[model samples]
Target chain A: MNAILECKGLTKSYGGKKALSDVNLTIERGRIVGLLGPNGSGKTTLIKLANALLTPTSGEIRIAGMKPGTGTKKIVSYLPERNYLNDWMRVHDIIGLFRDFYGDFRPDKAYDMLKRLNINPNDKLKTMSKGTKEKVQLILVMSREAELYLLDEPIGGVDPAARDYILETIISNYNPEATIIISTHLISDVEKILDHVIFIREGQVVLSSSVDEIREQGKSVDGLFREVFRC
Target chain B: MLGKLLKYELKATGRTFMPIYAAMLIAAAVTKLISALTAGGSEVPEFISAIVYIMILMGMFVMTFVVMIQRFHKNLLSDEGYLMFTLPVEPWQHIVSKLLISVLWNLGSLVAAFLSIVILTFDEIANRALMLDLFAVIAEFLTIFGPTGSLVVLEIFLAGIATTVFGILLIYASIALGHLSNRHRTMASLGAFLGLTAFAQILFACLTLIPNVRVLQHYMDTLQESLQTSIALFHYVMWFTIGFFTLLSAGYFLITNHILKKRLNLE
Candidate 1:
């Protein structure tokens, strides 16, 4: 259970281009790990594989010693990068859907967050602005009492103000035993909360270390990211 | 888990279909009322209302087809797959839930159309006898076969359900196959559906050319013989039809589930 996610030589390719190649990694529980990478750097690919949205081309990725399937999905809550919410449903109905499908989902907590954000539960998703929809999706994900939370670019699409609120919601909601992997190129905004970071570039893991380790070397995660992924 | 999936699937799809059904029934009622008012007068108003009824009928049919395809593609193969596929439900449950809901809507559309037609034609005096006569004829036809008669009716009902399930699964299978391509998914899905239809036709043709001719000759001969032989033969053919469609539906369901589980790449 300590290694919440373990990838053993995981490889995934699209057509002839490899998204991730023979990668091996382990993410432990009870830590906020930043899957830090530039665009098209295989961060999302790894996340999708973990979520069972896409199967690996070869090798294996396991969650809590099990392959990605219904069992793992029960413990994993995902906030995808896109607006996956249907335009037809109200926020209340969508919350009901989450509560219906995921036993870990907490509708009361979701409603409370919506109220704090001034989002009406009765409002249809289509009428909401892009930022508002993103906030709503984040609230749904954070409201889940899941063992692992996979937030794919949770703050990437929001304003600086909303990003702070989203980060605050995520930090305060997740229990100590749960792990959160926030994948984004906005490394500076998320650096303060990340206990560890995994630097990926061109579908390869270049670095996996604790924040204190980087700080001990007199380098901020943001500065280190800029230097490592410099164009 | 499957029950939960179906509950939400019904909720999501009900919004589009329920309105179409209600509109169709309303148009039918209006057509009936207009005809009753005009009774032997100018036919123009009746014709116009009939036209409106037909237009609504067309809308129902088109929406049935569109909703079946759109629900699967938009819900599972689009961005929404991020939500659906991640559910703690198994992939097959998603397939089954969507398939069951599609079959329900398909049957619902048919039932609505039938009821609308009944409303359009019903008259308290004239059609009462007509309806009774129709039922009497059906009852007499069934009585001719004795006990096997009711079994024949049941088999026919099963065949209808099997065909409906098979048809929907074919579309689901095609969509899943098309999703494996790199681009132009709608066109690819259309192609896959055409290919599957052609393949089924060819297979049926091949089967007919083989032992099917002899089976048909034997079946016809049994109709000329004793009652028991004829009943047995009827049972054989009816079961074959139901079993064949059920088997094909299972294959398509498997194809859809496997593709969605293994090769899904949502944009």
Candidate 2:
């Protein structure tokens, strides 16, 4: 499979401090990859850089052979770490907005997912709980027929049951030819679904391997992560 | 696409503004009813005039507040921006949408306020033949200008509206530019606003000084003498104003696009 995302010597800094430093990564198509990292490990920074939300201090990144811009943003579905959906909008209005803005937005898919999740279309975002909002966001992102789905901690604020539903929704809804990158430190729960894993520590990738390869080495991804991040 | 953008833009702002519009209408109707009830005799009172003026001022204040708050929420805090930026549309579209909505609302409020004042002070206005005379004067002015000159006047009016929109965008761009910095976002916005105002003043000063140059002065005198008619002068001013607004709007658009595209940091 061709690499859908390529980053070479990607570096970002806030003021004088580094957020991501000299990081290199390549992600192929049709893979559910886990970006595992502890707090302040630059997962969000990397995701932002890839989404063109921030310009790199130095180095390069390419999403599907195009630099991050309106062009790349067109084919990339991004779920920001926080609730980026406007609180004043109704669920149906949000869907309408997405459909109007993105040519690849799948409203039927989103509506179906929301129905399955028992989420009302007319509910205001402000009234929904945080977990529900995250799920709504996830549903919208997953509904898109995008080339790459960049999810920053989709399950970070949700309960375990909702997390499972989010993961399942993501898995079931995504186009098989596309890639999904889920950035989170919750390894054990996501480990079962992630085909490949990239572990980031201190803004650098320390491990990149397939789940089967790690399991074949007589250790689970969770155990390896503990060993690698051991105090 | 512009139509769709404008539809949603109006919807977002109308959430707050619709209630205000309704209140203004109600106030206008109430004032009309009260004034009619109290005008038992032929004469209107000085106190009534004062009340009318106060009501007009209040309406204007409310309108301005609604505009400022809508802009702040839509451009700054609301997730509406996420949808805004992600649109296949360009940055200019966003600016245009906001500007159009602001102008539309302002015009609507001005008309409503004017109608309210008319109702409250109907005796005075009718006694003075304000409505009839005003329409007659406008007709006479248009007749003097003829069709082409009237068209120029219309163009000038539209340019004036565009300039007002550009002014609003400049404020937004200033704020966005200031927020691009990591430290002192508010202070930076204030500084940027002052700097932009100073730059505009300098530009105006330079334009004013151009006629002081010998060669330019001679050219201006020749042009002034040749274009002596009011219609000609109106055309010149209209074209000049259009050009000026077009330049300011271009600058505003460039700055806003650059900030949104590259320098955005959602703090």
Candidate 3:
């Protein structure tokens, strides 16, 4: 299988403290990969590096055989940990903006997702609750026919119902041939959709295995996470 | 891409500035009506003229510096920056869009404010045939400056305007830089501003100290000479202004590109 994303000895540091260190990861095409880690485990940092949002301090990262840059960013749809959508924009305007910028953005698909969530097209982002805003952001990201989707904390801070809806939207909307890398601590909720999982601890990759293999080994991904992250 | 970027830039800026432009026109019309009604009615008070001048000057000042910079910063650097940087456009296009928007609005505000003052002082100005003579003299002066001098003067003026826009973009870049950190986004923005201002001031001081750095001084001298021959110094200032802005613009582009490429933290 061809790897859509390959990071070799990736390292990042903030001042003297390291965020990611000597981390190597390879994600193949057509796989839903879970980037599992605790707080400050560098999941977001890794996603940022892959998305070209942050440059690596050292080591190399390649997205679909190209260095992380404008070219790579064009093909990678990123859903950041926090709400990156401007609160001043209405849902329709946000859709328009996405369509304007991303040639592959499917506005009808986005509208369908919004409708499914019962989000009004004319509603301003500021009027929506945080969970709804998150869903809106997710819809925008998933609406793109991108090669790689990097979702950081995709279901964070939402109720169980909203979380299920978000996961459903993601699973239903994503291109089957594309890759999705979801970084989150909510492993139990996301485990079912993930084909592969990488467990990171203190900025290092502690474990990487397919969910089927781990389950065949008579352990749930969450149980394995607890075993690996036990401190 | 540039044309489209600029079109959107202008639209974004216009949304904030159209109201101000309308207000200026209304004020001008009111001033003209008042001046016409009061002309030779009972000897208009000097205080009224002073007030009009002050109002026009105040409006021009706000438009040039406060309104223009604030709008540019808000649209291009604030939270809206996410939308801007992610637009699949180059950093240069972003800088150019903001620069052009600033220049267009600056010129528009100036014209609007001048028209207002003209309306208020129309009687006095018309009685002296100032506008007609000024235009005639300007035409004659342009002929004397010749195409080369005219081009040089134009470049210089554009450079100046470019410099102001570049300065504003640099400020925006600094804010983006500060946001990369985990703490003190506001303080970092302020620090970036102070640091950038100090850096520019020092650079300017150094340039002035150099005897051969004559572009600005030479342009200023030519402008003084041009003014005597009936040409307004506006064009000449704009030429060097463009040059100054071009350099600042380069800096702005570089800094913005670096930030967007490297330390972009959406949160």
Candidate 4:
């Protein structure tokens, strides 16, 4: 496999409950992979493992042929589900922080994104609406010219217009030599832009295939999701 | 990268600390001004003025601990951890950044506290003899404890600095350990902190009782009234305090690093 992301017997658990279990997967570079799963279907667990936010139970995860640490963190840009920006800092301060830490961060590009969305650079995060804060986070993550992007629920909690903008931002900003793994519940909204899709269910990988392959089977990705994970 | 982390750490803390320090200094000046203006008119209650000064110092002291705890918890264990740990820096950089900034602020508050007291309470008219009064104080201590008393005093002062830094790192280590909990993290941290403090205090208290009381008793029984003996005892006590806290500081630093690197559960 020409993989940019790889997991071997990867397992993670909290207490006695398994979040992910004995899973092996790989995603090639230069593709937008949608990590589709139910709310507690281990999608975020897998992503967090990749980000080094959570340690595994029994196995290993590798990104870009290296373990997750200072080295891999250099090339992996992560957009967490929660609002992680410090409320007291101005928008520009966060951009400065990104610039300071990530060598791949493009401040000009981030500024352009911020201006396009009408966010004031000098505004504190507490002054911004929740939607604006989410947009700012997306802008920072997307501005990084990293080898891997792990965005967890990127389009959630935003208006449709902003949602469209975020999706378009993801599409237009895709680097042919890099990989993007977006984990979200709004599969239909993101399916059109996704090049590959993986469906996880209850700590197991139920399906992993390309979007074209799902279409060749005469089924929309969203349709297959509902069929696979119905209540 | 370490420099950048330190810069941001300072920036993050300076905003709140600077304002508090300025307000305390201003309040001290205002109290002095009121006392100066009322020197001849009517008696301003000394107790009330004393309270104002003490309260400012106490607030600064308490907030030193509070702010350090909050900064470590909120910055490294809360949602902000997602931003921090993802940065292209080793986890130790984060710990060191917090440690250095915390020590800087702790020492800064102490200096500010001392200066505020001097500014508020010093009387210029009596200040004409302040130099002689200082020498008189030195001579008094010297007669009681001898020449090495000065060295012991210096060592004690240095020990105070080490103790503060070590105590702060103990809190950091406790909080790092508490971060292992998915629920009750705050409570866990508080318990760890109190437990560690009690452990260190008990350990140090036992060590103190072993020699301080016994040595003095032995000196008295032997009828050896040499000032040099007292000076030697003073030096040993000061160095012991300094060495003990330095050891605590190193131990806490290692434990904090271990938990942060191996058992990190930033929920």
Candidate 5:
């Protein structure tokens, strides 16, 4: 079977500045890979490329043996860092949107998640707090039975308690046979759940190894991240 | 997928349009009532209501234009783009869905405006006769060409639709071109629109300068010579106009789609 994602000499540049350069990597299936990086470290760019939001400047990247496109989008459930929901829609209306577009979306799963979070189905997004909106977004993303889940900064802006809930939701809800590439800077928070860690700095992959390998070498992923990315 | 995209597009844009249409009808009803109650007395309320009705009719069109621009920009090119572009649909489906919905709302507002006017004058026998006479004149005008007249009328109606689609696609293309720039996107869009408009006008002007393309005017000049030839020329011109706009709309569609697919910059 093909790796869940593969990149060959993938490079992306904005104007003259390269966001990602010569990025050659592969991510296998069924692993919770932490794509650890700092701000503006091309983590979002890489995620955006995989989602087909932005075209790569050169080379190519593939998802499950197919290029990033409608086919790839079908199986990759993405949770962008920004609030992408419109203010005019209610929670249920958004669920309906997901149901209309994503064949793999589980509306029952989405409603259950919303119920557990105490988010009313009829509540308008405009009235919801930022944290509540983020939770709702996360719930919608996690409810998809997708083959690959690309979550960009899933815990970046939430409080510690909500962060824990988000993490727990991510752990409990995702498809076990699928892969999850979480792009985040909060290393300590997500370190425990991650089976593999890929350290990216200055738009280049610095380290790609399993968490067990790092632990065997007597270093936590967080400690290694601090050493590699300290300014 | 296009059908689903259009369904959501309608729902999203209808929220802004439906209320205004209802307001227009209500204002028309109030105007009629105020004029009826104060037939020979105070005209102030009637005047105010009439003005309100007119303002709403004008506002509906303005809002239609604003919503068209906003739907394309905000829904497809802003932060919401993350959700939209990631859907398992092609970029052209997004453009076509938005275009279809925008055209639907445009036609809906026109129908509502005409309905509101009819409501304001429904009770007046003179106004009813005037409208019937207008329709009779149009009917008589169509019956002149016999069977060909209906086809001519259909062509004209299609030309109207083609023109509307062309205008919307032009705007889409401008916005897409503007988005390629990293800074001053709105300004770039406006510039692109103005630039495209001027180029089209100049191209048409240059086309008219060619003697071969002056067949439209030649047909008009020879109208007294033969009615049959004039009708044929009319059909030719209408088809040419329809085809011209459809081709242009296709060009604009391709430009917009290419930009959205490969050159998208949703920063």
Candidate 6:
């Protein structure tokens, strides 16, 4: 009941094909959890359900005791897998949007990050490169001081060096009182940062355990993930 | 929150629309300049100006509808839907912000078109004559229908607004339905639109038939009285349809909200 995120018997299907089924999970506050899975294995699906981007076919998902709704939306900082900012918007305009909509959003923090990254506030999103767009999205997502952060594929599109920078950003901006659920396939890159890892495949969790426990078992989360979801 | 959403929505959509609006006004100005330069000779510039003027008017009309759909689908149902629906605002507020701004822009477009026309044909004597003629006709209309005619005008205006809302809601509901599809979303939306239009046509036809054939059958016997009575009945029917449309728009809004809130399957 005290968990920041709870999903009970959550199922999502599209046109009779099940993307996720009978997902029962709980994420406690103040931990960076890795939601690791192969492509099309429902990592994004669960994250989307938590963010209310997609609704459950049955059962329910609750973030902070409330159902996925405008209320939960207020406290859930979501970085969708796609580039969601309007192309016409300037970098600062979107930053302003997050600030205006979310009371927890810190504009000063956002500006600092953008300035450090050398992204001009006046540049339109369409003018930025693909990698740069992802960075901007990350900045916007990290600037919010929310109770729950749902990041779907946060580092998927970036290069190796950019991925490190993004990880650094997530680490530095990590809110100890807030839970962070990061869904990504690059398990090794995030393994060191993850306190816990949920191994999901074929729309169900095969393993949910602490990173220490996995390491003590003489296997990295990445190795176990390969073993668990091997083709 | 709704105000903030409106501000952002307007800012996002204005970039697309303002340029077109400015082009329309510029076209109007260019047409006037061409007329002045031509000075009633060399018909080529005038002919080209007329085409440009007509094209700008048509472009504005078409762009208005395009911007409306883009605002709803691109902002709320496309990839950007990720950002939009995640905002701490309710779905109803989303609808209201878009609807209120849409109505405002619709009126703005109308005013812009009017101003463009006035600019294009701004000869003082002719405009004065035109205004006088328009007022004289309205005065005569008021004289015949008296207080009832005023009521009719008000009802017609209300009905016009209702129809615009109904059209927007239909598009919105269709877009919501289309989002339920996994692929070919544009085609799906078009199909939804056509399906709704078919249903609406049948409903309105039934409404028109029931009154004209059955309800007003008695008044058909008197030729002169039927004219006035028909006008009166038409007035009543306008109000009735307007009420029906309002309910339909509300229903569409509820459907759209349900899709966004509960059945949302964003791609």
Per-residue C-alpha lDDT of model 4 across residues B1-267, encoded as one tens digit per residue:
999999999999999899889888887887787788777766556447767767877898888888898888899888999999899888889988998899899989988987787777678535768758888987897667655657766796789789878978998989987787777887998888898889889988887887579887866675576566656666777898898899889888898988877777666
- Model 6 docking grade: high
What pairs collide in candidate 2?
none
User: What TM-score against the true fold does each predicted structure earn?
Assistant: 0.96, 0.88, 0.81, 0.93, 0.96, 0.95
Evaluation by DockQ, superior candidate among 3 and 4: 4
Candidate 5, residues B1-267, lDDT tens digits: the string is 999999999999889999999999999999998998999998999999999999999999999999999999999999999999989999999999999999999899989998998888877635678778889999998887779888977898899999999999999999999998878999999999998788767765665557445686777677787777777877877887898788888988999999998887678
User: What order do you get sorting by lDDT, best first?
Assistant: 5, 1, 4, 6, 2, 3
Model 4's i-RMS, to one decimal, reads 0.9
* Best prediction by lDDT: 5
Model 2, A1-231: lDDT tens digits are 558999999998888888999998999999999999899999999988887667788999999988877788788898988777776799999899889878999899999999989999999998999889989988988889998999999889998888888888888888789999999988898988899999998999998999899989999999999999997
In terms of lDDT, model 5 sits at: 0.91
With candidate 5 superimposed using the best TM-score fit, by how many Å does residue B127's alpha carbon deviate from the native?
6.7
Q: Candidate 3, DockQ to 2 decimals?
A: 0.33
When candidate 5 is compared with the true two-chain complex, its DockQ is 0.82
Model 3 over residues A1-231: C-alpha lDDT tens digits?
568999899998876889999988888899899999999999988887776556678999998988876677688888878766755578998888788778889999999988988999999998999888888888999999999998989899788988998898888877789999999999899989999999988999998899999999999999999998888
Error of 6 at A222 (Å): 2.6
Error of 4 at B159 (Å): 0.9
lDDT against the true structure, each candidate: 0.90, 0.78, 0.76, 0.87, 0.91, 0.87
Please rank every candidate by TM-score, starting with the best. 5, 1, 6, 4, 2, 3
Tens digits of lDDT, candidate 3, B1-267 = 687777766765676577766766666666566656676775465446556656755766576676555654565555565456556677667766776777787778777777766776767786777778887897876676565456655665656566656766776667766766667877887887788777877876665457435655665667656544433344544543465556766775677667755666544
Report how far residue B180 has shifted in candidate 1, in Å: 1.9
Q: Which clashing pairs does model 1 show?
A: none
Q: List the candidate numbers ranked by DockQ, top first.
A: 6, 5, 1, 4, 2, 3
> Residue B39, candidate 3: how far off, in angstroms?
7.5
* Candidate 4 C-alpha lDDT tens digits along A114-133: 99888999999999888899
